[model samples]
Target: MIKLYGMTGSGNCWKPAVLMKQLGQPFEWTEINTLKGETRTPEFLALNANGRVPLLIVNGRKLAESNAMLCYLADGTDYFPADRWQRAKILEWMFFEQYSHEPYIATVRFWVHFMQKQEEWKDKIAEAMKKGHAALGVMEQQLQKTSFLAGARYSIADIALYAYTHVAHEGGYDLNAYPAINDWMKRLEAQPKFEKMTG
Candidate 1:
């Protein structure tokens, strides 16, 4: 069995949780309240030097970074591509999600959903939202050309970005304006094994 340390509502953490259930794997989940600095403690730091949520403890090995875990768990699974070029494309999207998508999407989600844009984060929300929209546009353009991020098949590349793109509206980015993303979201939702982060 695997053990996972996560915050209840975190998009990064939710990625593995949803995938585990979708994959029919059994794992233990320990909720860590990041708002209370639970992850910064020495105990958690030993697990992940970065002190981040979405830590995966499998076979006594601990790993951090949500996208990394997605790739790790997907070994020998359909979510992992068999072809070298397709596999590279999957990794490409995973890297894109971390560098280009999460900063804006997750940050804006924090302001709109949790803080209500009430603090110093307020001044930067608009700009962040703009970048977030641009990131979605990048996904939209790819999705329009291909059925999935890598190709026709669903892969961890989809899982990586799907972690937050589904709820980008929580960040005040309108999905209605993105027909391709909206359509893609529905397709993901329609997967028979689909599991949602929030009830």
Candidate 2:
């Protein structure tokens, strides 16, 4: 069985959980309470020196990084593309997701919803959100033109961004301005095997 260490509400963690449900794969979830410093402990640190959640332990070997794990589990599955160029395109979007998208989107959620009254990050929070919406604007532009991010078909790229984007409001970004993004989000939610991140 695959064992996953992640916080339930995290977009990165939700990536695998959502994929498992969509693919009908069997797995066990062990939520790592980062708020309690569970991920920083010796045992957890051994799994990932970065001390991040969403670690996938398969057959005693651990894989870190949420998007990387998504690629691993999704290989040869419907979520993965068979065409090399298309696969490359998917990777491009995945890279953009981690670099351009996650920093802002995830940070906003962390600051606004999760961090709460932690004044330490208040300034960074406000700054991240402004950048976050700009990132969403990129998505809105792509969603306006293309049905999905990578190819004409739905792929892991959609799943990669969907986790945080769907809940972007929690980060204080208004979705009403991006009708195309909202429509695309609704389409993803309407998929036959779609799964929600909130447990």
The C-alpha stretches of model 1 lying farther than 4 A from their native spots are 118-120
Per-residue error for 88 in candidate 1, Å, reads 0.5
Please report the candidate that would top TM-score against the real structure: 1
Clashes (backbone N, CA, C under 3 Å), per candidate, total 0, 0
Please write out the lDDT profile of model 1 over residues 1-199, one tens digit for every residue: 8999998878899988878877898999999988899999999998989989989999999899998898888877888967889899999999999999999998889787876764667769887878888999999999898888888988888888988898787777778877888788788877768876782
lDDT of 2 at 133: 80
Candidate 2, residue 23: the lDDT equals 88
- lDDT of model number 2: 0.86
- lDDT string for model 2 (119-191, tens) is 7677877778788888889888888889988757888999999988988888777889989888888889987
Worst 10 residues of 2 by lDDT: 117-126
